[model samples]
Target: MAAFTDSDGTCLFNLNDGKRELVNGAEAAQALVDKALAGRDHTAITRICLSNKSYDEGAAGAIAEALSKMTSVTEADISDVIAGRPEDMALRVLAAICGGLAGRSLSLIDVSDNAMGEKGVNACRAALEGQRETLSALRMCNDGLSASAMEAVRDLLVAGDVPTRLTQLHFFNNMSGDGGAKALAQILPHCPQLRDLRFSGTRAGRPGSVAVANALAACPAATSGRFVSLDLADNTFGTEGAAALATVLRKQANLTLLSLRDGSLEDEGMVAVANALRGAAPALRSLDLSANDCTGACAKAVARAVASCTKLEYLGLEENDGFGSAGAVKLAGVLGGLKQLQRLQLGQCSIGTRGAVALAKSLEGLDCLTSLELNGNAISEEGMYGFTEALGAAGKLSALGEMDDNNAEASEEEEEEESEEESGDEAEAEEETEEAAADASVDELTAALGGVKM
Candidate 1:
């Protein structure tokens, strides 16, 4: 770890020892905090990281007493604390105490990787509301937030005396469903400064996805090109959701990264999204559409769209088994235009001998190309030989992800396993979606959307 102090009074008090130190009891936690803060000015601390620890109420109270004195602290990372009732209660006590601090205002608060549920949200409400004037980012990933808990968050955002100055909100891998999505949509317009929004793996389907897209389409930040990164991966967007999202994407000129991986955007949905990218999102640096069931036609559309994105550094089109050698050749045709492309992920897209050869030829023009992932693409010995020779001649390729198992002889078994895995994944995803939907009722979503157009 680097020294905490800087010239500008921005200091970090990091207590995260890469999960090596176990500060379990109150005495241990107090001793650790005292030692870490020794010889340091409490009022000058700007950040505190206490991730991956164990604490009871007494330990949390001691930590809170220290935090209360650090009035300048703006960022707090209390993620991955030990999971249990005592730890949860400790977290609540810590948050409540911090919330009561008279002059403290946080800019970023991350409580990710904790199974705190609704009680955790309630405990943090005061702290969140207290910083409505300065809080910028809130990350609560994998926190077991349900639809009602999400609604509680929305209420907190609006209940403050002034609208929150939030710029980033990450709520990934929760069971929020459509109700939670609708709740978020209701609050999007209030967060005019929001730029980075990540709501991936929330089991949101078409209705939820469409609601969010419609909200973004009307959001002032999104319309004014202030939005930059949007990640909605691991959800079931399907065609309708993709179409809705496409409309939003067309308007995001300042967007840099767009991730819609594993969203079930089949050929039709992918084509819609690709068309939206055409002559749009010129500032995009990374675009991920992996496992989207794209084929040669989708690949052609993406190639045409990305040909104009000369600044693109990463393009991930992996796991789309329908994207065969033909698609690879189509993409290769436009590789010459993407001079800035460094990492290209084409793993398991069925790019065989002919496509590998074409890509090898195209590699000659990419001076910046470093990493190329072609794993399980069925490239035979001859194709690998030519590709390796091309890589050696280019001298820019350093990290090549390919194995002997990718050869033709083992490709059949690999493809079969891949197909079976894909089927199983889809079935599991469907069940999860259904379970989430059951948890959140239709009336709840409708009420959350009250008068909001979607």
Candidate 2:
């Protein structure tokens, strides 16, 4: 039930005495469009998400129509849908409509996880180029389109009437290969206002990666645009590619967040990065190296490097191919050493009870951690218990997840260990026992002296 509610526990869409009934995507979209046109005194529903829902025919078109009609709509998010091939045609229509609308203000439109083929993507590019002022954030992630489609997207970006507020553009997990990325990187010099770019799971190879890195390296600080975010997850950027990119990062001081998660960053690549950002990029705050085949040594090096960059706050190492129990322990040990660490992501790292215990110990020493996302791991009941026990011992915590019986048992063990504070008394009792033995021996000697011994 991903529904929004008001202060009175009433659903936002369930207003107006139940006059607006929307059980499906089409219905909801139609209601929103109709309501906006009629001035029905309702909130703007242009920003919508159609996840885990059924849809009727031409649902995408209906959504696009509602979005196009709303002049005040700033975003439209409808991910994980299987709109038909005809959906692209509808999207084009919406794009045309968005271009023609005088008061159109739609800035974002997310249609990710929809296997809209190459054709659909072409339509998307056409529409976006046509309505550049109104559309900025476009998410076509997790779709199936060849490299050519991505190139088309790049070409469309080059088209005139481009908007400047286009900050985020996510096309990750799509099969847009190197050719597409090349096309995109070519436009980097032109897009002076682009801030965030996500290309994870795309075939952004050495050539494409080099193009992007070069573009970033050459981007001047005085330029109106800065690549604040760069996500290259699940790409095939080996050491050569990473080395080239690392060179760019070394010089690109304006980058605030850099994510190489799922990229083919190996030990060599890690070393390259370690050399690159040792002192450069002082303003960097977020770095994600997840799913990279980097071992504990690499992670330790990374942590050490980050420790020097005092402004860094969020570091993600989840789902790495080489981070094991040893790696987790090393990282946990260094956790408190970092003074500005606020958010840490270690999801799916195969952490066990020992790793959990180490992390708990680290948490006990820290006072700044705000949120920790530990999903999809082997953290059994014991791990959860250790975390809570540490929280209780530390006397304060931002937030912690649920704990099972095993966690409770671990906590009890910790409490028991804490209660044994009178070790001096036990030592004194042992000394007294030895003294009594000596006294008994002396009494026997006295008895023998009195001629009363057996």
Candidate 3:
């Protein structure tokens, strides 16, 4: 009964409505294919996920053939399904889908964790050539893609016959280094619709990161005010790379989400980014400076950045041990005015009891704040108790509204009336019956529905 479904109710591998509880072997695969083929709305099969399914080559080939016949499938995830075999078998399984899905209007394709090495990528390149006009997203994370395979991917990105529609690309945990990054940089200006790009943990060093930053800066979409999100975490991009991206941030008005976690963006680089936010980046909402080496000196810059961003919502500063009590107090000073701020993560920042109390006092002013992560900090029982008391007092103030002490007796009488209603009197109660039980259940459901605010 496990499956994946979209908001539109289109699903893949959903056996919930099927007659059988469980299915197995090539026969079950064929049955699944038959059901798909017999369905009137083949286009409803927008996602074909065979992840973690135990099936043989015959079953895989049948499913691939069935998928090829579908009129339109936007997203397909075939990760970890071709297990217990050589990489070539996995490549063949992918080839079948690529052949069928060629020239189809498939937007997103994920083949991560399949161990499909260079040959598999080469085959996918051929298959993807037909989808040059339609494919907008491709995820090949942890698939053993090397620097050589990236050359083929680069060619596909810059194919001259048709304008590339790629908007999102992920190559996380790949073996590609500066060479692969340079290849990708050449096509960044070509993809005007590119919104989300991730190269985390891909061994893209300083050179690679700088190249990406340059390409992003030169990209027409970025310069023309199209919103874009870029994640370059764990790449060891040093101060020079961070400075280059800071320049990009100053120019790219639509650049919203930027994640440079686990990189070498220390105090200097952090200050550079914060300065960019303070000067430019008005539309910026989410900023993740986590796992960096930022110290307390960068706190004022970050606070200024938050103050500048009137619509800032999510700020992630996790694993930056340099931000101690002083930094927390500095940040708390400005958070009172950020009515739009909601999610804040400051885990492992060395914030002590005093800092926690400072933050808790600020939290009272932020009515929009909902999520706060403070794990791995130095907050003790007293600090936590202070936060609890402050938050509880704020909750009561919000709940009581305009009610004053003068209405205390009226409130008590109302509570008594509710208690009486909850514990109905035996003298006036009717005998319990099947109809009464059903009516009570209906009443309970109605009351529950009425209690819902939204």
Give each model's whole-structure lDDT. Answer: 0.75, 0.58, 0.67
Q: Alpha carbon lDDT of residue 184, candidate 1?
A: 87
Cα RMSD to native, each candidate? Answer: 12.0, 17.5, 16.8
Query: What's each prediction's TM-score?
Result: 0.82, 0.62, 0.75
Q: Give the alpha carbon lDDT tens digit for every residue of 1-454 in model 1.
A: 2123446534877677555444555687778777767668888788887776756666767777777888888887777654564654755654644463436678888877766667777777666666678889999899878888789888877763455688999999998888888888888888888899999988777788778877877877777778799998987788878887888788888889999999888999999998898768889999999999888767667776777577899999999987876677767767766789989999988776656666666667787788889887877665567677776676645757755557565353444444554444334434433443443366467778897887
Cα-based lDDT at residue 236, candidate 1: 77
In every candidate, how many clashes are there? 0, 2, 0
Shift in Å, residue 36, candidate 2 = 3.8
The sequence of per-residue lDDT tens digits that candidate 3 reaches over residues 342-389 is: 788888887665565566666676677777777677655545566557
Candidate 2, residue 225: CA error in Å?
A: 8.3
Write the candidate numbers in order of decreasing lDDT.
1, 3, 2
